[model samples]
Each structure stands twice: as C-alpha cells, then as structure tokens.
Target: MSEKNERQLRIVGFLCNWCSYGGADTAGVCRFKQPPLLRIIRIPCTGRMDPLFVVKALAQGADGVLVSGCHPKDCHYAVGNFYARRRLELVKRFLPFVGLDPRRFHYTWVSASEGQRWQEVVTEFSAVIQELGPNPGIGADTPMETAGQAASAFA
Candidate 1:
C-alpha cells in the first residue's frame, strides 16, 4: 500500500439487499474497520446484477469488483444467488479475455448478522488486490491525469 506507483485501487462492491448489504451496514455500526477502497452498491437481489455492470465498473477505473450475497440456501429470493453464480462464471472468463487480472473480481456470501465475516472478506479481498498491484489497464492511458479522466477513457 506504500509503493509510490501503487495506485489506490478503486473497488465497486455489489451486495444483496437483504443480506450482504445489511451485513455491511452492521459492520459499520459495530465499527468494524474495513478498507475504504470499496464502494458498496446495494441491489434488490444478486440476480439483479448484470454482466454489463461488472464490465462497466472495470471500464470506469475500478481496479476490482466484489459481489456478495446470501449464502446458497439463505437467499431471501430463493434462487437469486444461483443466477448470480451462473452469470459471474461468464464474467470470470471475460476478464481474462480483456487482459484484466482475473483476480480483480471476487464473490462471496455474507449474512445480515455476519459483521465479522464481512470485515474479514473485505480484508482478504483488499489484501489480494494490494498483492496484485494496481490495475494498469484502467490507468495506463493517463497516469498523471485525474482519475475521472482516466476512468472515462477506460469506460
């Protein structure tokens, strides 16, 4: 995290409304520190996620994206996680096709009360991203330019 060129990787996080989102909220209320790198976007269900959203986040300068939802048998929407799993499988392939580090994307499940788990996940994911270094493709076009400009160009 201290390297001069180690860009602070912007991360977009998609969390299921009922579980993962609440878990994140709980973490915050409990003061469980997690990396500020992530920007959380709550969705009605994991099934609501579109592959386009993932691509767009990456294109817009997010060095990584994380998707969290209810566990397999815990989804309030019953099958939302199932659909998400299937769709992300394709995203997994597409990341590599575009020369992105496939490790930039991560998926997990966090229940409403799992504040500790939520914190742990963020810690691990952020660590991995730090290890991978910054996403060169997103900022390669304009290293000295404003992040917004770079993101727009990538997008």
Candidate 2:
C-alpha cells in the first residue's frame, strides 16, 4: 500500500447537520481526540440519506461507513431520525447481498451536546474499520485500487 493509504483508513461518516455534525464539531473544538480515519460529510438530516449512497461508498473501497443523526425523540425535523433509522436498518440487514459485511456499516444517534459521546462513537467505529482492513471489492478490481477514482466520482 502507498504511504497515504497506509496513513488513514477509508472510513466515511455521513452526519446530520443539526445534531451529529454539531456533536462532531464540538468534539474537535473541545480538543477531544478522534481517529483520523473518519472523513465526514455533513447532510441536512439523516432522513435524507439514500441507502444506495452508503453502498456506493463501500463498493468504492471505504472500509467502514457510519451514519449518525439526532436521537429518536429529539430530531430537529420531527420524525426525520425515525425515517433514517428504518432505512439504515433495512440496508444493514441486506449488506451481504451486495458482497459487503453488515459489520462494515453502522448507524446511531448523538445530539449536539454529546461531544464526549461523539468521541466514543468515532473511536469505536474506527477500531472496527481497522480490524476489517481493506475491502477487495465485489468485482475483479480491488476497492483500494479503484476507491480514489470512485470516491472522486461521488464527491
């Protein structure tokens, strides 16, 4: 592996802006250390996440994916987190159909005030990804080899 790839695991985080994202920001501002592997993408709400996008990231060679949003009863947008929970659960159950391990994907809740919880969440998830290592991908090409190209396509 190249030095760059060796330096960071390909872990993607799709965080809801109103809650999880803020929580992460708080972690940073508070100087609570987090793993360097997690690359964050702030979304309006987890309810807006498309299952396909999570699959696509894994297919493109991401070692792990984390989707976090507001707590169930505390979503800024009412039932938004509920919708996200349902979709993410369905996707988690069927990861094997796409040749990905269910363990590679995770979803959870963290409010804006939960900076310490955010640190714990990221640390735990990053360890899981490190244990899993690289994904060889479903097809002939390996994810590590094609991830750069595929990641750019989506970014």
Candidate 3:
C-alpha cells in the first residue's frame, strides 16, 4: 500500500459498555471488516461521558470522535444515554466555535444485538472522517484574536 493508503485516520470511539461496545464486539466476532481507524474506549455508561474527553482527543490530534451508546429509552442504566445525547450535542455544536470542524464529532445509539448496524455506523463515520481529512489541531501559539478570526472564517 502507498503511504497515503497505509496512513489510517486517528478516530476515537467512546462506547458504552452495555450496548454499543457489545455491538462492536459482535461485529468483530462476525468478521466484519470495519475501517481500522478507531481506538475504542469502553466506558461504563454514556452518562459517564464528558465533553472534555472529546475536546482532549481532538486537541491531541485525533481526526474524529464517535460516541455510541444504548438507544434512547433503552439504556441499561435507564436514562444514561439521554444525558449523553444532550451533552454530546452541545459538544458537537461547540466544536466549531473553538475552530474545530463540527463534522469531526458524531454520536449515535446501537444495541448489542445489532452487529450489522455497528459495522454500518463505523464504516459510514470512517468514510466521513476520511472525506474531512485530518484535524488541524488547536495551537497554543496563535493569539486568541487570530484564532477567533480563523474561527469566523471557518464559519
């Protein structure tokens, strides 16, 4: 493979242990060929997700972030995913304000039994990240004014 093809995008997946993570495991057992981009972090529940986690991942050079959990009203912890949905939505919207591409972050729900759905979600999100390319990263050297100007231009 050419260097370009060999270079996999750095994607981070924060998966809820009860559902989405199991779905990913099921996809693996089924031998689904997902893009080898994501580095999965299994969290106890979607409620445990912190917006700073996504921000830190992007700031540290992750190309994209994906947060998957149990379907709404289907959370193993009852309403964990509900809280996740709200927080993740806020983070997704706020990313652009900080000069990051909002498209670089995505969140969804998947159940443990839905192996095929897990494969589809990862494939689709990976393709989207590939299209967006690598994250430019938030730099410390750039003055706040310049960064704000750049953010506006990006908008």
**Using alpha carbons, what is the TM-score of model 3?**
0.86
Tell me the whole-model lDDT of each prediction, alpha carbons only: 0.82, 0.83, 0.86
Worst 10 residues of 1 by lDDT: 146-155
Off by over 4 Å in 2: 1-7, 139-155
lDDT of 2: 0.83
| Stretch of 10 with least lDDT, candidate 3 | 146-155
lDDT of 2 by residue, 1-155 (tens): 75435645788899999999999999999999988988899999999888778878887778889999999989988999999999899878766654567788999999999999999999998888777777656443345445345434434
How do the residues 93-152 of candidate 1 rate in per-residue lDDT, one tens digit apiece? 766555567799999989999999999999999888877776766434434355344334
Off-target runs (Cα >4 Å) in candidate 1 are 1-6, 138-155
- Residue-level lDDT of model 3, residues 26-143, one tens digit each, is 9999999999999999999989887788877887889999999999999989999888988888888878667788888999999999999999999999999888777777544446
lDDT of 1 at 43: 94
On TM-score, the leading prediction is 3
